[model samples]
Target: MSTTRTILICSGKGGVGKTTTTANLGIALARQGAKTVVLDADFGLRNLDLLLGLENRIVYTAQEVLAETCRLEQALVKHKQEPNLALLPAGNPRMLEWLKPKDMQAIVALLERQFDYVLIDCPAGIEDGFKNAAAAAREAVVITTPEVAAVRDADRVIGLLNTQGVQPVQLVLNRVRPKMMSNQEMLSVDDVTDILALPLLGLVFEDEQVIVSTNRGEPLTLSDSSSPAAQAYGNIAQRLQGEDIPLMDPSQARRGLRARMRKLMQTRIF
Candidate 1:
Protein backbone atom coordinates (compact mmCIF):
# COMPACT_ATOMS: atom_id res chain seq x y z
CA MET A 1 0.00 0.00 0.00
CA SER A 2 1.14 3.54 -0.79
CA THR A 3 2.18 5.53 2.28
CA THR A 4 0.66 8.81 1.17
CA ARG A 5 -2.95 7.98 1.99
CA THR A 6 -4.91 11.25 2.01
CA ILE A 7 -5.51 13.85 -0.71
CA LEU A 8 -7.86 16.78 -0.23
CA ILE A 9 -9.69 18.36 -3.18
CA CYS A 10 -10.31 22.03 -2.41
CA SER A 11 -11.19 25.33 -4.13
CA GLY A 12 -11.73 28.86 -2.87
CA LYS A 13 -14.70 29.52 -5.14
CA GLY A 14 -17.74 27.66 -6.47
CA GLY A 15 -18.73 26.36 -9.95
CA VAL A 16 -15.21 25.21 -10.80
CA GLY A 17 -15.68 21.37 -10.96
CA LYS A 18 -14.06 20.69 -7.52
CA THR A 19 -16.52 17.94 -6.58
CA THR A 20 -16.70 16.46 -10.09
CA THR A 21 -12.91 16.28 -10.23
CA THR A 22 -12.92 14.66 -6.78
CA ALA A 23 -15.49 12.01 -7.78
CA ASN A 24 -13.85 11.07 -11.08
CA LEU A 25 -10.30 10.98 -9.62
CA GLY A 26 -11.54 8.48 -7.05
CA ILE A 27 -13.01 6.47 -9.92
CA ALA A 28 -9.66 6.57 -11.70
CA LEU A 29 -7.53 5.45 -8.74
CA ALA A 30 -9.89 2.62 -7.77
CA ARG A 31 -9.90 1.26 -11.34
CA GLN A 32 -6.12 0.90 -10.96
CA GLY A 33 -6.76 -1.50 -8.01
CA ALA A 34 -6.00 1.04 -5.26
CA LYS A 35 -8.25 0.90 -2.23
CA THR A 36 -9.76 4.38 -2.50
CA VAL A 37 -12.28 6.23 -0.39
CA VAL A 38 -13.79 9.57 -1.38
CA LEU A 39 -14.89 11.58 1.65
CA ASP A 40 -17.37 14.33 0.84
CA ALA A 41 -16.57 17.41 2.94
CA ASP A 42 -19.02 19.62 1.09
CA PHE A 43 -21.18 20.09 4.17
CA GLY A 44 -24.51 21.67 3.12
CA LEU A 45 -24.01 21.46 -0.64
CA ARG A 46 -23.42 17.72 -0.38
CA ASN A 47 -23.35 16.74 -4.06
CA LEU A 48 -20.53 14.16 -4.12
CA ASP A 49 -22.73 11.18 -3.17
CA LEU A 50 -25.34 12.24 -5.74
CA LEU A 51 -22.68 12.53 -8.44
CA LEU A 52 -21.68 8.92 -7.69
CA GLY A 53 -25.37 7.76 -7.72
CA LEU A 54 -25.20 6.58 -4.10
CA GLU A 55 -27.55 9.07 -2.47
CA ASN A 56 -30.27 6.62 -1.39
CA ARG A 57 -27.78 4.10 -0.02
CA ILE A 58 -26.09 6.62 2.35
CA VAL A 59 -27.48 5.52 5.70
CA TYR A 60 -24.38 6.30 7.77
CA THR A 61 -22.28 9.48 7.56
CA ALA A 62 -19.02 10.93 8.88
CA GLN A 63 -21.09 12.71 11.47
CA GLU A 64 -22.41 9.36 12.71
CA VAL A 65 -18.89 8.13 13.30
CA LEU A 66 -17.91 11.39 14.98
CA ALA A 67 -20.89 11.12 17.25
CA GLU A 68 -19.80 7.59 18.17
CA THR A 69 -23.07 6.15 16.90
CA CYS A 70 -21.54 3.84 14.26
CA ARG A 71 -18.26 2.33 13.13
CA LEU A 72 -16.50 3.97 10.18
CA GLU A 73 -16.79 0.70 8.27
CA GLN A 74 -20.55 0.74 8.79
CA ALA A 75 -20.68 4.31 7.43
CA LEU A 76 -18.87 3.40 4.20
CA VAL A 77 -21.17 3.22 1.18
CA LYS A 78 -19.72 0.91 -1.46
CA HIS A 79 -19.69 1.74 -5.14
CA LYS A 80 -21.74 -0.56 -7.36
CA GLN A 81 -19.03 -1.63 -9.79
CA GLU A 82 -15.73 -0.97 -8.02
CA PRO A 83 -15.34 -3.02 -4.86
CA ASN A 84 -12.07 -1.24 -4.12
CA LEU A 85 -13.73 2.18 -3.96
CA ALA A 86 -16.02 3.43 -1.18
CA LEU A 87 -17.53 6.75 -0.03
CA LEU A 88 -17.90 8.36 3.38
CA PRO A 89 -20.50 11.08 3.01
CA ALA A 90 -20.36 14.42 4.79
CA GLY A 91 -23.42 14.97 6.88
CA ASN A 92 -25.93 17.83 6.35
CA PRO A 93 -24.93 21.49 6.78
CA ARG A 94 -26.96 22.27 9.87
CA MET A 95 -24.96 19.80 11.97
CA LEU A 96 -21.57 19.81 10.25
CA GLU A 97 -20.27 22.88 12.05
CA TRP A 98 -20.49 21.00 15.32
CA LEU A 99 -18.05 18.32 14.22
CA LYS A 100 -14.81 18.95 16.08
CA PRO A 101 -11.49 18.98 14.27
CA LYS A 102 -9.83 16.50 16.64
CA ASP A 103 -12.51 13.92 15.98
CA MET A 104 -12.01 14.38 12.26
CA GLN A 105 -8.24 13.83 12.60
CA ALA A 106 -8.80 10.67 14.64
CA ILE A 107 -11.17 9.27 12.06
CA VAL A 108 -8.76 10.02 9.20
CA ALA A 109 -5.90 8.28 11.02
CA LEU A 110 -8.06 5.24 11.57
CA LEU A 111 -9.19 5.17 7.94
CA GLU A 112 -5.64 5.47 6.60
CA ARG A 113 -4.99 1.90 7.70
CA GLN A 114 -7.83 0.50 5.56
CA PHE A 115 -7.22 2.33 2.27
CA ASP A 116 -4.41 3.26 -0.08
CA TYR A 117 -5.90 6.67 -0.86
CA VAL A 118 -8.39 8.81 1.03
CA LEU A 119 -9.70 11.74 -1.01
CA ILE A 120 -11.50 14.45 0.93
CA ASP A 121 -13.87 16.43 -1.32
CA CYS A 122 -13.81 19.85 0.31
CA PRO A 123 -16.57 22.41 0.09
CA ALA A 124 -16.13 25.55 -2.01
CA GLY A 125 -15.07 28.76 -0.26
CA ILE A 126 -12.48 29.32 2.51
CA GLU A 127 -14.52 29.20 5.62
CA ASP A 128 -14.65 27.01 8.72
CA GLY A 129 -15.85 24.19 6.50
CA PHE A 130 -12.83 24.49 4.27
CA LYS A 131 -10.50 24.52 7.32
CA ASN A 132 -12.06 21.31 8.59
CA ALA A 133 -11.78 19.70 5.16
CA ALA A 134 -8.09 20.50 4.76
CA ALA A 135 -7.08 20.01 8.40
CA ALA A 136 -5.47 16.59 8.27
CA ALA A 137 -4.58 16.31 4.60
CA ARG A 138 -0.89 16.18 3.67
CA GLU A 139 -1.46 16.73 -0.07
CA ALA A 140 -4.10 18.53 -2.11
CA VAL A 141 -5.61 18.92 -5.60
CA VAL A 142 -6.93 22.42 -6.31
CA ILE A 143 -9.23 22.47 -9.39
CA THR A 144 -10.36 25.46 -11.40
CA THR A 145 -11.64 26.40 -14.84
CA PRO A 146 -9.93 28.78 -17.32
CA GLU A 147 -12.04 31.75 -16.28
CA VAL A 148 -10.27 34.63 -14.52
CA ALA A 149 -12.52 34.39 -11.49
CA ALA A 150 -11.76 30.71 -10.99
CA VAL A 151 -8.07 31.24 -11.61
CA ARG A 152 -7.91 34.05 -9.08
CA ASP A 153 -9.68 31.99 -6.44
CA ALA A 154 -7.32 29.11 -7.12
CA ASP A 155 -4.32 31.36 -6.43
CA ARG A 156 -5.87 32.35 -3.14
CA VAL A 157 -6.42 28.70 -2.27
CA ILE A 158 -2.81 27.91 -3.19
CA GLY A 159 -1.61 30.67 -0.88
CA LEU A 160 -3.73 29.33 1.96
CA LEU A 161 -2.45 25.81 1.39
CA ASN A 162 1.10 27.07 1.74
CA THR A 163 0.19 28.93 4.90
CA GLN A 164 -1.16 25.68 6.33
CA GLY A 165 2.14 23.93 5.43
CA VAL A 166 0.48 21.74 2.82
CA GLN A 167 3.13 20.86 0.28
CA PRO A 168 2.54 20.25 -3.45
CA VAL A 169 -0.89 21.72 -3.95
CA GLN A 170 -1.51 20.48 -7.51
CA LEU A 171 -3.79 22.27 -9.96
CA VAL A 172 -6.35 20.90 -12.46
CA LEU A 173 -7.61 23.22 -15.20
CA ASN A 174 -11.07 22.04 -16.28
CA ARG A 175 -13.61 22.91 -18.99
CA VAL A 176 -11.05 24.74 -21.12
CA ARG A 177 -12.55 25.62 -24.53
CA PRO A 178 -9.69 25.50 -27.04
CA LYS A 179 -11.22 27.69 -29.75
CA MET A 180 -11.62 30.72 -27.50
CA MET A 181 -8.02 30.52 -26.27
CA SER A 182 -6.62 30.65 -29.83
CA ASN A 183 -8.90 33.61 -30.56
CA GLN A 184 -7.43 35.26 -27.42
CA GLU A 185 -10.89 35.59 -25.87
CA MET A 186 -10.45 33.06 -23.02
CA LEU A 187 -7.77 32.07 -20.54
CA SER A 188 -5.55 29.33 -21.96
CA VAL A 189 -3.92 26.57 -19.92
CA ASP A 190 -0.70 28.56 -20.00
CA ASP A 191 -2.54 31.65 -18.83
CA VAL A 192 -3.99 29.83 -15.84
CA THR A 193 -0.69 28.13 -14.99
CA ASP A 194 1.15 31.42 -15.18
CA ILE A 195 -1.35 33.09 -12.91
CA LEU A 196 -1.77 30.34 -10.31
CA ALA A 197 1.91 29.26 -10.36
CA LEU A 198 1.25 25.77 -9.01
CA PRO A 199 2.39 22.39 -10.33
CA LEU A 200 -0.03 21.43 -13.12
CA LEU A 201 -1.79 18.17 -12.31
CA GLY A 202 -4.30 17.83 -15.18
CA LEU A 203 -6.12 19.79 -17.82
CA VAL A 204 -9.65 18.72 -18.86
CA PHE A 205 -11.34 20.05 -21.99
CA GLU A 206 -14.87 21.34 -22.14
CA ASP A 207 -16.73 18.11 -22.85
CA GLU A 208 -20.46 17.58 -23.42
CA GLN A 209 -20.15 14.13 -21.94
CA VAL A 210 -19.20 15.75 -18.61
CA ILE A 211 -22.55 17.51 -18.39
CA VAL A 212 -24.51 14.41 -19.41
CA SER A 213 -22.70 12.26 -16.86
CA THR A 214 -23.17 14.77 -14.05
CA ASN A 215 -26.91 15.13 -14.74
CA ARG A 216 -27.29 11.36 -14.70
CA GLY A 217 -25.42 11.11 -11.37
CA GLU A 218 -22.64 9.09 -13.02
CA PRO A 219 -18.98 10.05 -12.75
CA LEU A 220 -17.08 10.52 -16.03
CA THR A 221 -14.19 8.17 -15.20
CA LEU A 222 -16.27 4.99 -14.69
CA SER A 223 -16.37 3.70 -18.28
CA ASP A 224 -13.48 2.33 -20.36
CA SER A 225 -13.87 4.92 -23.12
CA SER A 226 -11.68 8.02 -22.99
CA SER A 227 -13.26 11.42 -23.39
CA PRO A 228 -11.01 14.47 -23.05
CA ALA A 229 -12.09 14.96 -19.44
CA ALA A 230 -11.98 11.27 -18.50
CA GLN A 231 -8.46 10.80 -19.80
CA ALA A 232 -7.32 13.86 -17.89
CA TYR A 233 -8.78 12.47 -14.68
CA GLY A 234 -7.10 9.12 -15.26
CA ASN A 235 -3.77 10.84 -15.83
CA ILE A 236 -4.31 12.79 -12.62
CA ALA A 237 -4.72 9.54 -10.70
CA GLN A 238 -1.39 8.32 -12.03
CA ARG A 239 0.28 11.62 -11.19
CA LEU A 240 -1.06 11.29 -7.64
CA GLN A 241 0.67 7.92 -7.46
CA GLY A 242 3.99 9.77 -8.09
CA GLU A 243 4.10 8.63 -11.72
CA ASP A 244 5.34 10.97 -14.44
CA ILE A 245 2.49 11.13 -16.97
CA PRO A 246 2.58 13.88 -19.59
CA LEU A 247 -0.46 16.13 -19.53
CA MET A 248 -2.52 16.51 -22.71
CA ASP A 249 -2.15 20.06 -23.91
CA PRO A 250 -5.66 21.53 -23.90
CA SER A 251 -5.22 22.97 -27.42
CA GLN A 252 -3.97 19.61 -28.66
CA ALA A 253 -6.90 17.79 -27.00
CA ARG A 254 -9.72 19.44 -28.98
CA ARG A 255 -8.90 18.27 -32.51
CA GLY A 256 -12.45 18.08 -33.82
CA LEU A 257 -13.97 19.96 -36.83
CA ARG A 258 -14.78 23.08 -34.80
CA ALA A 259 -11.23 23.36 -33.50
CA ARG A 260 -9.81 22.77 -37.00
CA MET A 261 -11.91 25.62 -38.38
CA ARG A 262 -10.84 27.91 -35.52
CA LYS A 263 -7.18 27.03 -36.07
CA LEU A 264 -7.50 27.80 -39.80
CA MET A 265 -9.14 31.16 -39.06
CA GLN A 266 -6.37 32.09 -36.63
CA THR A 267 -3.65 31.17 -39.18
CA ARG A 268 -5.35 33.34 -41.82
CA ILE A 269 -5.58 36.27 -39.37
CA PHE A 270 -1.78 36.18 -38.86
Candidate 2:
Protein backbone atom coordinates (compact mmCIF):
# COMPACT_ATOMS: atom_id res chain seq x y z
CA MET A 1 0.00 0.00 0.00
CA SER A 2 1.25 3.48 -0.94
CA THR A 3 0.89 6.61 1.16
CA THR A 4 0.97 8.87 -1.88
CA ARG A 5 -1.95 11.23 -2.34
CA THR A 6 -3.31 10.61 -5.86
CA ILE A 7 -5.62 13.46 -6.68
CA LEU A 8 -7.36 14.21 -9.97
CA ILE A 9 -7.82 17.83 -10.98
CA CYS A 10 -10.86 17.95 -13.25
CA SER A 11 -13.65 20.15 -14.60
CA GLY A 12 -16.77 19.09 -16.43
CA LYS A 13 -16.61 21.98 -18.86
CA GLY A 14 -13.67 23.21 -20.89
CA GLY A 15 -11.91 26.55 -20.18
CA VAL A 16 -12.57 26.42 -16.44
CA GLY A 17 -8.85 26.54 -15.44
CA LYS A 18 -8.40 22.87 -14.56
CA THR A 19 -4.90 22.63 -16.03
CA THR A 20 -3.91 25.99 -14.58
CA THR A 21 -4.89 24.87 -11.09
CA THR A 22 -3.04 21.59 -11.48
CA ALA A 23 0.13 23.29 -12.71
CA ASN A 24 0.20 25.94 -9.99
CA LEU A 25 -0.84 23.53 -7.25
CA GLY A 26 1.96 21.14 -8.25
CA ILE A 27 4.54 23.92 -8.04
CA ALA A 28 3.12 25.19 -4.75
CA LEU A 29 3.22 21.72 -3.19
CA ALA A 30 6.75 21.12 -4.42
CA ARG A 31 7.93 24.51 -3.14
CA GLN A 32 6.67 23.46 0.30
CA GLY A 33 9.13 20.50 0.21
CA ALA A 34 6.74 17.79 -1.00
CA LYS A 35 7.84 15.49 -3.83
CA THR A 36 5.07 16.12 -6.40
CA VAL A 37 4.48 14.85 -9.90
CA VAL A 38 1.75 16.22 -12.17
CA LEU A 39 0.53 13.51 -14.51
CA ASP A 40 -1.05 14.95 -17.64
CA ALA A 41 -3.94 12.52 -18.16
CA ASP A 42 -5.37 14.66 -20.93
CA PHE A 43 -2.80 13.28 -23.32
CA GLY A 44 -4.98 13.69 -26.41
CA LEU A 45 -4.82 17.46 -25.92
CA ARG A 46 -2.12 17.73 -23.28
CA ASN A 47 -0.56 21.11 -22.47
CA LEU A 48 0.55 20.68 -18.86
CA ASP A 49 4.15 20.32 -20.02
CA LEU A 50 3.80 23.62 -21.90
CA LEU A 51 2.32 25.31 -18.83
CA LEU A 52 5.14 24.02 -16.58
CA GLY A 53 7.81 24.98 -19.19
CA LEU A 54 8.93 21.34 -19.36
CA GLU A 55 7.63 20.56 -22.86
CA ASN A 56 11.04 20.54 -24.50
CA ARG A 57 12.57 18.41 -21.77
CA ILE A 58 10.09 15.53 -22.11
CA VAL A 59 11.90 12.88 -24.06
CA TYR A 60 9.51 10.13 -22.96
CA THR A 61 6.09 9.71 -21.38
CA ALA A 62 3.98 7.27 -19.32
CA GLN A 63 3.26 5.37 -22.54
CA GLU A 64 6.93 4.70 -23.09
CA VAL A 65 7.40 3.73 -19.49
CA LEU A 66 4.44 1.35 -19.59
CA ALA A 67 5.56 -0.18 -22.85
CA GLU A 68 8.94 -0.90 -21.27
CA THR A 69 10.69 1.24 -23.85
CA CYS A 70 12.05 3.64 -21.22
CA ARG A 71 12.59 3.83 -17.50
CA LEU A 72 10.19 5.84 -15.34
CA GLU A 73 13.00 8.24 -14.38
CA GLN A 74 13.74 8.78 -18.06
CA ALA A 75 10.10 9.63 -18.75
CA LEU A 76 9.87 12.01 -15.82
CA VAL A 77 10.71 15.61 -16.78
CA LYS A 78 12.12 17.29 -13.68
CA HIS A 79 11.21 20.95 -13.33
CA LYS A 80 14.24 23.11 -14.09
CA GLN A 81 13.80 25.38 -11.08
CA GLU A 82 11.65 23.17 -8.83
CA PRO A 83 13.44 19.86 -8.88
CA ASN A 84 10.94 18.58 -6.33
CA LEU A 85 8.29 18.58 -9.06
CA ALA A 86 8.09 16.52 -12.25
CA LEU A 87 5.70 16.21 -15.21
CA LEU A 88 4.63 12.97 -16.91
CA PRO A 89 2.40 12.92 -19.94
CA ALA A 90 -0.05 9.99 -20.06
CA GLY A 91 0.80 9.15 -23.69
CA ASN A 92 1.52 10.60 -27.10
CA PRO A 93 -1.54 12.24 -28.61
CA ARG A 94 -1.35 10.18 -31.77
CA MET A 95 -1.13 6.92 -29.89
CA LEU A 96 -3.74 7.48 -27.18
CA GLU A 97 -6.42 5.44 -28.94
CA TRP A 98 -5.43 2.38 -26.92
CA LEU A 99 -5.45 4.03 -23.54
CA LYS A 100 -7.88 2.57 -21.01
CA PRO A 101 -8.74 2.80 -17.33
CA LYS A 102 -6.41 -0.04 -16.39
CA ASP A 103 -3.57 1.62 -18.26
CA MET A 104 -4.14 4.79 -16.28
CA GLN A 105 -4.22 2.80 -13.07
CA ALA A 106 -0.93 1.11 -13.94
CA ILE A 107 0.82 4.39 -14.61
CA VAL A 108 -0.43 5.92 -11.36
CA ALA A 109 0.47 2.85 -9.34
CA LEU A 110 4.06 3.28 -10.46
CA LEU A 111 4.00 7.00 -9.66
CA GLU A 112 2.61 6.46 -6.14
CA ARG A 113 5.69 4.58 -5.02
CA GLN A 114 7.99 7.59 -5.52
CA PHE A 115 5.93 10.74 -5.15
CA ASP A 116 4.33 12.32 -2.12
CA TYR A 117 1.63 13.79 -4.36
CA VAL A 118 0.33 12.68 -7.76
CA LEU A 119 -1.84 15.33 -9.35
CA ILE A 120 -3.60 14.17 -12.50
CA ASP A 121 -4.67 16.90 -14.90
CA CYS A 122 -7.84 15.35 -16.35
CA PRO A 123 -9.46 16.25 -19.64
CA ALA A 124 -12.67 18.25 -19.59
CA GLY A 125 -16.07 16.55 -19.76
CA ILE A 126 -17.58 13.24 -18.59
CA GLU A 127 -16.29 11.12 -21.42
CA ASP A 128 -13.96 8.13 -21.51
CA GLY A 129 -10.99 10.35 -20.76
CA PHE A 130 -12.58 11.44 -17.52
CA LYS A 131 -13.60 7.93 -16.55
CA ASN A 132 -10.07 6.69 -17.12
CA ALA A 133 -8.58 9.53 -15.07
CA ALA A 134 -11.04 8.96 -12.22
CA ALA A 135 -10.29 5.26 -12.12
CA ALA A 136 -6.82 5.83 -10.73
CA ALA A 137 -7.53 8.75 -8.44
CA ARG A 138 -8.12 8.33 -4.73
CA GLU A 139 -9.47 11.86 -4.41
CA ALA A 140 -10.38 14.78 -6.72
CA VAL A 141 -10.62 18.56 -6.97
CA VAL A 142 -13.47 19.57 -9.26
CA ILE A 143 -12.92 23.04 -10.73
CA THR A 144 -15.79 25.28 -11.83
CA THR A 145 -16.66 28.87 -12.53
CA PRO A 146 -19.64 30.70 -10.97
CA GLU A 147 -21.69 30.06 -14.09
CA VAL A 148 -24.85 27.97 -14.01
CA ALA A 149 -23.69 25.68 -16.80
CA ALA A 150 -20.30 25.03 -15.22
CA VAL A 151 -21.91 24.35 -11.87
CA ARG A 152 -24.42 21.99 -13.43
CA ASP A 153 -21.68 20.10 -15.19
CA ALA A 154 -19.58 19.94 -12.04
CA ASP A 155 -22.54 18.49 -10.18
CA ARG A 156 -22.79 15.72 -12.74
CA VAL A 157 -19.07 15.07 -12.55
CA ILE A 158 -19.28 14.79 -8.79
CA GLY A 159 -21.94 12.10 -9.16
CA LEU A 160 -19.70 10.19 -11.55
CA LEU A 161 -16.79 10.48 -9.18
CA ASN A 162 -18.95 9.10 -6.42
CA THR A 163 -19.92 6.11 -8.54
CA GLN A 164 -16.23 5.47 -9.19
CA GLY A 165 -15.58 5.45 -5.45
CA VAL A 166 -13.44 8.59 -5.52
CA GLN A 167 -13.47 9.71 -1.92
CA PRO A 168 -13.58 13.20 -0.45
CA VAL A 169 -14.26 15.14 -3.63
CA GLN A 170 -13.50 18.79 -3.06
CA LEU A 171 -14.44 21.95 -5.00
CA VAL A 172 -12.32 24.77 -6.41
CA LEU A 173 -14.33 27.75 -7.62
CA ASN A 174 -12.31 29.50 -10.34
CA ARG A 175 -12.64 32.70 -12.35
CA VAL A 176 -14.26 34.42 -9.40
CA ARG A 177 -14.86 38.15 -9.83
CA PRO A 178 -15.43 39.54 -6.38
CA LYS A 179 -17.25 42.65 -7.59
CA MET A 180 -19.66 40.71 -9.73
CA MET A 181 -20.25 38.22 -6.98
CA SER A 182 -20.87 40.97 -4.43
CA ASN A 183 -23.17 42.80 -6.82
CA GLN A 184 -25.14 39.60 -7.42
CA GLU A 185 -24.21 39.67 -11.09
CA MET A 186 -22.48 36.33 -10.70
CA LEU A 187 -23.19 33.28 -8.61
CA SER A 188 -22.31 33.80 -5.00
CA VAL A 189 -19.96 31.39 -3.26
CA ASP A 190 -22.91 30.18 -1.24
CA ASP A 191 -24.89 29.53 -4.40
CA VAL A 192 -22.17 27.30 -5.85
CA THR A 193 -21.55 25.43 -2.60
CA ASP A 194 -25.28 24.88 -2.14
CA ILE A 195 -25.51 23.31 -5.59
CA LEU A 196 -22.34 21.21 -5.56
CA ALA A 197 -22.56 20.15 -1.92
CA LEU A 198 -18.82 19.68 -1.57
CA PRO A 199 -16.24 21.13 0.75
CA LEU A 200 -14.84 24.41 -0.58
CA LEU A 201 -11.17 23.70 -1.07
CA GLY A 202 -10.28 27.13 -2.50
CA LEU A 203 -11.36 30.16 -4.46
CA VAL A 204 -9.33 31.54 -7.41
CA PHE A 205 -10.16 35.08 -8.44
CA GLU A 206 -10.04 36.13 -12.06
CA ASP A 207 -6.65 37.75 -12.68
CA GLU A 208 -4.94 38.88 -15.89
CA GLN A 209 -1.62 37.71 -14.44
CA VAL A 210 -2.80 34.12 -14.88
CA ILE A 211 -2.94 34.63 -18.65
CA VAL A 212 0.48 36.32 -18.66
CA SER A 213 2.06 33.50 -16.67
CA THR A 214 0.43 30.79 -18.82
CA ASN A 215 1.66 32.29 -22.07
CA ARG A 216 5.18 32.56 -20.62
CA GLY A 217 5.13 28.88 -19.59
CA GLU A 218 5.47 29.84 -15.94
CA PRO A 219 2.74 29.19 -13.40
CA LEU A 220 1.94 32.12 -11.11
CA THR A 221 2.77 30.11 -7.97
CA LEU A 222 6.23 29.28 -9.35
CA SER A 223 7.53 32.64 -8.09
CA ASP A 224 6.95 34.94 -5.16
CA SER A 225 4.14 36.72 -7.00
CA SER A 226 1.83 38.82 -4.85
CA SER A 227 -1.10 38.40 -7.23
CA PRO A 228 -4.36 37.44 -5.57
CA ALA A 229 -4.61 34.23 -7.59
CA ALA A 230 -1.07 33.25 -6.62
CA GLN A 231 -1.75 33.85 -2.95
CA ALA A 232 -4.97 31.86 -3.24
CA TYR A 233 -3.13 28.93 -4.80
CA GLY A 234 -0.50 28.99 -2.06
CA ASN A 235 -3.21 29.08 0.61
CA ILE A 236 -5.01 26.18 -1.04
CA ALA A 237 -1.81 24.14 -1.02
CA GLN A 238 -1.39 24.86 2.68
CA ARG A 239 -4.94 23.68 3.36
CA LEU A 240 -4.31 20.51 1.37
CA GLN A 241 -1.36 19.77 3.64
CA GLY A 242 -3.79 19.86 6.62
CA GLU A 243 -2.81 23.37 7.74
CA ASP A 244 -5.73 25.19 9.38
CA ILE A 245 -5.70 28.27 7.14
CA PRO A 246 -8.86 30.36 6.94
CA LEU A 247 -10.48 30.88 3.56
CA MET A 248 -10.26 34.32 1.93
CA ASP A 249 -13.20 36.65 2.32
CA PRO A 250 -14.79 37.97 -0.86
CA SER A 251 -15.86 41.21 0.84
CA GLN A 252 -12.29 41.82 1.88
CA ALA A 253 -11.12 41.09 -1.66
CA ARG A 254 -13.51 43.70 -3.05
CA ARG A 255 -12.29 46.24 -0.51
CA GLY A 256 -8.68 45.43 -1.38
CA LEU A 257 -9.43 46.05 -5.07
CA ARG A 258 -10.88 49.45 -4.24
CA ALA A 259 -7.78 50.33 -2.22
CA ARG A 260 -5.50 49.39 -5.11
CA MET A 261 -7.50 51.59 -7.47
CA ARG A 262 -7.28 54.47 -5.00
CA LYS A 263 -3.54 54.01 -4.67
CA LEU A 264 -3.13 54.06 -8.44
CA MET A 265 -5.01 57.36 -8.64
CA GLN A 266 -2.89 58.84 -5.84
CA THR A 267 0.35 57.75 -7.53
CA ARG A 268 -0.70 59.39 -10.81
CA ILE A 269 -1.72 62.62 -9.04
CA PHE A 270 1.60 62.80 -7.12
Best by lDDT: 2
lDDT of each: 0.84, 0.94
lDDT of 1 at 90: 63
Per-prediction count of colliding residue pairs? 0, 0
Worst-scoring 10-residue span by lDDT in model 1: 96-105
Score candidate 1 by lDDT: 0.84
| Residue 121 miss distance in model 2 (angstroms) | 0.3
Per-residue lDDT, model 2, residue 151, is 97
TM-score, predicted candidate 1 vs. hidden true structure: 0.91
Top TM-score model: 2
Candidate 2 residue spans exceeding 4 A from truth: 256-270
Residue-by-residue lDDT tens digits, candidate 2, 70-186: 999999999999999999999999987878999999999999999999999999989999998999999999999999999999999999999999998999999999999899999
Q: How far is candidate 1 from the true structure (C-alpha RMSD, Å)?
A: 4.4
